[model samples]
Target: MNKKSLSQQIYEARWCYLFVLPCSILTGMFVLYPIGMSWYFSLLDWSGFTKDAKFIGLQNYAEAINDPFFWNAFSRSFIFMFGTVPVKIILGFVIAVFLNNQVLKLSPFFRTIIFMPVVTAIAIIGIVMTFIFSPFNGPANKFLMATNLTSGPIDFLGNPDTVLPTVMGVYVWKWLGITMMYWLAALQTVPQDVYDAAKIDGAQGYRLWIHIILPIVLPFAIVIILVEAVSALNVFPLIETMTAGGPFFSSEVMEVYIFRTAFVTDAGTMPRLGYACAAGVFWGVAVLFITALQGFWMRRTRRI
Candidate 1:
């Protein structure tokens, strides 16, 4: 058997390359171009309104590093990620396990019910949630009052103290089903014979899960957690529609901060497109670092 030359291999795979050309072009135009432009813009001092963009290297980044509001938004993003990722992982795992049980009737229906929110528009959900948690004439407040849980109507989306947590809850509820699906896929990888063998060895209930099931699913859990953590940083739509980072900017995350800086010009303020791009670049780097860390951990786990 003769080994094919590079030219021959290229010729043979020409059709495959032809098929991928359109998608590659689209990605280059839409994704790569924007990302490259963002980095370039980050190095400038521009208001996005005029062509007078002065090239200022690292000044925007230095400003961002010292900006209190930027740090506040950054910290809030981490808080949201920390608060929601664990709950989503744990609850999603449990629900997936419950749904995976052979004795569970109408599991498909239950799954559909749980996953319905995932497909629903986030904007729509945000609007509905605001109404539901409205201080006056809302069902949530009405129920709370009826049950005497609170003395007055609670402003869920209005109060800074409760707004972050409220949005986190809604975020968890909206995306929990996706986490469940990940767990379900992981669970399917465990062979039934292994379960039967473990059962025969008296490893039942929690013991079986602790020793056998967990070990099998640990790898999957790592990936799922990383995905959820990254996803938690992308709560712009939900937060935008629900809170608009209001109530004293309690719910303002990095994306909202960037948007406000780049586009939303107040009475006397100019839209700092360059500064916003710097913030965005910083955020992108942070996400890359996190992903790299997770990848390192994954490799280490595999070695162990």
Candidate 2:
């Protein structure tokens, strides 16, 4: 290419990079920077309490595999992911469908009310949920008592049997709006002619959902499912705010456990920074794998 043409191209490229420089720098400092440091730290044995860091290779990973607490937390992540994603997707779709009906009035008001929690403080919701789950003097138990549904108080958050479910419920409440909004956007894009054709073909209700609406919204549904899967696997704030994975670690997800390992422990002037780094690395890799699989499935579905 001529020098003038090449110079013009270089100038354009330089300006493009300059425009994106701020975003790239922020991402590097906040995201890529930590990831790089974590990878380095994962190869060392550092009691986060001091500067006495010793390089220990893959020992932390070895210990992580054998650590019962680590495995328990890891397993809990999957269970919570499985419980939350399907419920969120299905309920969000149903709610979107219900609200989409022409007969529904004041739809914007209802949508705003539903989405309020999405903007609420995580700590506030956690505290409110904790109160609601309180066995004594909680509003929920008061309702149950007044209705005679149960004479006894239900310690929803305290009981190991119910902690996971309680957290799951909190997750649904927090995320349902976002998912519903997504579904609503997708539904609005559905061609009206398709529904008209379906009606003429004697397709209605469940048949229409199964044969028409679903097929058209399949791409939207796939995106939500994959997004939910990855997010649920990394669930933290609600758990952090509500249970703190407490009541005997019954509700502990991988995230809270990792943070606890990093900052909450002291082994006679020793901290476990390296182990925490390893755990962080493990979680990141797990998320990446799940995302890759999701992309593959989405591609296959679109092809079909």
Candidate 3:
């Protein structure tokens, strides 16, 4: 038989290419276009609304590098990432284990209940949480007062010392359900026969999880870690709804700073669209670097 020519091969796969064309076009339009625009805007000096965008080369980037507030917000982003990731992952894993148990009944109901928060509107959660943690007439404060743990409302979202951690706690709670679903799906992929063999070899209780379940679940855990890292680092809505970066910019993260610089400002000043874009570009590069590092680490783990 004669080998097919390149043209012949292309003709045979034309339908497959056609099927992918729409998705490719949409991705280019929405995702790729914005990224390119952001890079171009980063080199300019203009408010987003203005038609006259002055090209400023690397000045915006230089200013961002020296901006103390940018670094401060970046540090808070790291704190939010670290604080939320481990707690959610561990709690999610534990819940997944419990739900996976044969002895557990009505697990589907429980799963739906737990996962409701994951599907619920984040804006609603942030608003409700703000009220729950409100200094005046909030249930949380009332409970603390009733329990004699405090003299009055603690102002969880007010004080700089407590605001960041409180937000972290809320983030973990909101995301735990989705994290558990990841673990649960990973756990389901493990063969029951493997567990049976481990049991027959005298593996039970913590040993079963340590040796068998954990190894199988590790890849999924890596995915969860990366997802949570990105999500936590880019946190915006909750901070906006609950604290708006604070009483003193205590709970501010990179995203909050970007929004403020881009849109929010004093009465007479123009929004710093270019500066905000510069900050965004810098942090976007940093996030990409961190994610690439994480992927390399996961790949190495798979080899080991």
Candidate 4:
């Protein structure tokens, strides 16, 4: 209300601005600008790389809805998300319990081993997995062949049935470590006496975990689930690099589909920025929907 009060408030807030300025600028430049640009471009029939254009109102969005490829890619993404998130959460928790125990020596080393892939270049791993999953002469198939386990070679990325699952495998492999590390941090706070008391009550294994530990870790687990769901939805580079959603476009995610539509294909066929934005808007809505449902689930489960 007073000048001095206002001045003091402004003075205090000055450092807040100083601290936040860089992040704000970066968000504006990269995030806000691109979103606005994408929305603007989405309204046009602009070839992503060229100057030729037309203003198509709702046409692209209309086409995107009826497009079979859009729905197919979305379905594959859902499959990938369903496959990876549960396995990652369960395995990560189990691994975190082991890593957090005081009895373990070289805990940091083990932690690093689990988390190494998270830091490793995704592009490089894509190339490596491509070779490993190669039907012929790849080590994976070769090992299976060596063991007399059925056929000579099984197509991992090439086969329609297997491609989505293979990508899901890669998704879990890469993401599990990060989730495990989060669990390990949460594990440290779980009082040791709780486990001892559970043992005294004759509880062990799954019973102890279900009744005691998992509940304590519920918040972290929920956070990880929400983040993973959002990240998994946006997965594109690996989809592009690895499968290209090939074998009749079985694994093409929405992001990859949009990228190809906007930039790769010529305007003569499918350079539909508006369609891509519509796809993005639809995906964004789906993400929000899932997140909302997850939040509701967390609240419901938390009460129990």
Q: Which candidate is the best by lDDT?
A: 1
Runs off by more than 4 Å, candidate 1:
1-8
Ten contiguous residues minimizing lDDT sum, candidate 1: 100-109
Per-residue lDDT for 9-76 in model 3, tens only? 99999999999999999999999998999999999998989799999999999999899999999888
Give residue 152's lDDT in candidate 2 (0 to 100). Answer: 94
TM-score of 2: 0.94
lDDT of 4 by residue, 200-236 (tens): 9999989998899878887778878887777888678
What's the lDDT for all of these models? 0.94, 0.88, 0.90, 0.81
Reference-based TM-score of each model: 0.95, 0.94, 0.95, 0.88
* Model 2: pairs clashing at backbone N, Cα or C within 3 Å: none
Ranking by lDDT: 1, 3, 2, 4
Candidate 1, residues 1-304, lDDT tens digits: the string is 9999999999999999999999999999999999999999999999999989999999999999999999999999999999999999999999999999878889989999999999999998988999998998899999999999999999998999999999999999999999999999999999999999999999987899999999999999889988999999999999988988988998899999999899987799899999999999999999899899999998899788
Better of 1 and 2 by TM-score: 1
Q: Is candidate 2 or 4 superior in lDDT?
A: 2
Query: Which pairs of residues have clashing backbones in candidate 4?
Result: none
Scored by lDDT, model 2 comes in at: 0.88
